[model samples]
Target: MPPRRLLLRGVLTAALVAVVSPFVHVIDFFYRREAEGVKRQKIANMRDLTPGGFIYFSYPQTGDPKIDNDPFRQFVLIMTEDGQLRVYSRVCVHLWCLPSYIQTRRQLICPCHGSIYREEDGVAIEGPAAYQSYPTNALPMGKIEVDGNGDIWMVGVDGRIGYGREWHNIKPDELVRRV
Candidate 1:
């Protein structure tokens, strides 16, 4: 190969690698992360949330939200149309961007790509998830059960915890039945 051509190829390869490296890290961070001390955190009471209501809390988050947004543990608890209380993953299936509830439309809209999801069903209605490129369009929800104390206890996650993994990680001390 000519000297000029070889230099150009080397430079292009280096530049391409630099551009793609950050994207690879971003995707890895989204798809996979340490479960980070999986615990059934008590965020709110059943009466605190109205029917067809939503609330945000970061489980596994000890830092101040004003300082940093911990993407992993941010979750949304949704009161369904039939009065079932469920805590669903706020991460969008397409890009893993945090979605917020749109009060007027009563839908969860992804700020990243305008992905719309039915807050009740956790099903993707529009945007990148409409075509269903990901494994499951429906967001993974953690099971919230009313314990003997009448407080909402997040029992286990729907997807990974219920699939093949056991709930052994939840220590006995981690569970506090206080409202």
Candidate 2:
């Protein structure tokens, strides 16, 4: 190759590296950082929980209206037919659309893309979410425990909430727009 062509190629390669490195680091930073801990919030009482029914609630209670009321923060607590309690975030993994619980069907269905997930464990059963890679295809879940007093408290979320791979990595402007 000509010396001038080689020099131009080298310059372009360096420029590309320079422009792309920062974003790579930023993405790496988000992936490496630990998730923000969820606040232990009492969500429902077992005595009040009806079997095969659903209860809606929110988590973390960040106090910032944008974060607190963001649709992604919404969750559903359900009492399975076997009497086990499970909680799953309402945010659909495919497109961040809220999935509605169909009690009769025992599944969470996303209206946006018709993605369906098992209500028992938030596993994507069909549609686009089912076709995505692991975890991305699964809905975000919150860990809950029931105390002796029958109060159910949400202790933590299995993964970051919302549209992205990391919940904390969501764009602030999107949160503002969502709110």
Candidate 3:
């Protein structure tokens, strides 16, 4: 190779690295940093949720109107038989399609590719999904509290009032009683 050509190639490579490194660092920084200024809203009281049942709620903490702007705002709350409560994002790991609960199967089934997730822990039971589970956003359950009136309050991951039934809207009355 000619010396001039080699020198020009080296310079171009160095320039590309210099231009790309900062952007990569910035992306990494954002990914590593925790979401700030999030608001909380309580969607349901512990008493309201029956064991072995699940509640569907929206992200940015249920009911918050601001969550409507989030393209990825879907979530579910599951109350296990052991009284443990967990929240999960509804996006399927296989192809990022939204999954719906299959009542007959008692699991969340991704319609796009037949992926099944355990309602209890969001573990992938079967299908084309490579990940063992769905992705979950940070939901601070510790701040959830109920008032004397039995109303639920929760702090949402996003900085907004957790409001609305469209996301986490399953009411206790609507669920089929577990035998």
Candidate 4:
């Protein structure tokens, strides 16, 4: 009721707002996302990998050395028979060993568990899938696109990212920047 008391109350309210406003902005950082999103890395050449040919590379090349041990970070590009591009995660569906393409066999074969996948698309054809406790699931594939320039972009990992469980599936087009 006193003017002095009213002035003190006003000061307290202003101080409270000053302290809490930043917290509101911090909370928004976690919840708010822009309508236009991030740009994906152009990891490989589309034309270089002819049908059945393969090339290996890392995705999201952060400066962290600890990343060297992550299996999902590795990927391979395979050109399909019709020249459609497919980026297959190198980490095998079973036992998490990196699978390599055996040019002679014309398939991506896992050395650790002997799990095999077709080069064009990841399909479980043999190996660990036959065992009761072993996995029969196909290796995760990357959603791919060939831009107008004919460069291949890894848009997103098709399923849960390799053994690491990171998801990079923000569609490649979402990250495209306008000139």
Specify the highest-TM-score model's number: 2
In model 3, the worst 10-residue window by lDDT is 157-166
At residue 121, candidate 2 shows an lDDT of 66
Which ten-residue region of model 4 has the weakest summed lDDT?
A: 31-40
lDDT agreement of model 3 with the native:
0.54
> Where is model 1 poorest over a 10-residue stretch in terms of lDDT?
160-169
Q: Give the alpha carbon lDDT tens digit for every residue of 133-168 in model 2.
A: 765777766666667787888777766566424434
Q: In model 2, state the lDDT of residue 153.
A: 80
lDDT of 4 by residue, 1-179 (tens): 89999999999999999988878667656731321112266766656777767778766556576774567677877765665566667877667788897867778898888877766546657887324221235556665556777677765555544432224434323322222
For model 2, the superposed segments whose C-alpha errors exceed 4 Å read: 1-35, 62-65, 163-179
lDDT of 1 by residue, 1-179 (tens): 99999999999999999988888667666643435335565667778777778788766455678422666566787776666666666777777788887756777898999888776666688987656733366565665656655567665555532111133433222332333
Give the Cα error of residue 77 in candidate 2, in Å: 0.6
* CA error at residue 167 for candidate 1, angstroms: 18
Which residue pairs come into collision in candidate 2?
A: none
- Using lDDT as the measure, the top candidate is 2
Error of 1 at 75 (Å): 0.5
Model 4, runs deviating above 4 Å: 1-39, 130-136, 163-179
lDDT of each: 0.64, 0.73, 0.54, 0.63
Superposition-based RMSD of candidate 2 using all C-alpha atoms, in angstroms:
10.6
